[model samples]
Target: MNRLSRVSIAAFALAAGAALTGCVVAPVGPYYGEPVVTAPPPPQVEAVPVAPYPGWLWIGGYWTWQANRHVWVGGHWAAPRPGWRYVPHRWDPGPRGWREAPGRWERR
Candidate 1:
């Protein structure tokens, strides 16, 4: 009986881990913000180092908050390293309004 209980407990833990692996954690706060009337300055582009020899791509800016969740500043575009391409940040409008997606990199 004890061995059976231990097996059940292990199986339950494994199942729970597998279930959580597929679960998505929603952002803690509200998703959308009020649209701004005036557009901000063009995103600043900086020359970030490619670091290693192969070099990883540079992606566009992101909106990150300082202090609290009240404000989100935009990210900037950067020049690509030797073997990388810029992936632009895209915003999707759905029932929840704007959904900001991060940039990705693909081998050239």
Candidate 2:
């Protein structure tokens, strides 16, 4: 092939490969609408002890999916971030299954 034809073919192949890979890798977070049928067990109430240090916030415990079952993760103290509040993780029931919303820091 001529130089121009070879370059054009290479560029087209690269673009096509990127497009296909993007579709396969696009969903990075928890898979929604996955069939679970049964809801995860209720979260266990963990006693929030006194903060170990000043400006520490108590993040509550939550149930996490593991080995097709719900597992309890204990709560712990986290250093407070300026102008931000920590939101605790939670599992919400949906028609198909429970969706886990991970905890994150949000600006006040």
lDDT of each: 0.53, 0.78
Find the candidate with the highest lDDT and give its number: 2
- Model 2 regions more than 4 Å off: 1-35
TM-scores, all candidates, are 0.34, 0.63
Over 1-108, each residue of candidate 1 has an lDDT whose tens digit, in order, gives 699999999999999999899889866753334332333334556556454444334454555322333233444334455665556655555563445554666567
Cand. 1 TM to true fold: 0.34
**After TM-score superposition, what is the CA distance of residue 4 in candidate 1 from its true location, in Å?**
4.1
Which candidate comes out best when scored by TM-score? 2
Tens digit of per-residue lDDT, candidate 2, span 1-108:
799999999999999998888564443543534545567677787778999999898888887765666678898999989999888787677776667777889999
Scored against the true structure, residue 3 in model 1 reaches a CA lDDT of 95
Q: How many residue pairs clash in each candidate?
A: 3, 0
| Cα lDDT for residue 28, candidate 2 | 55
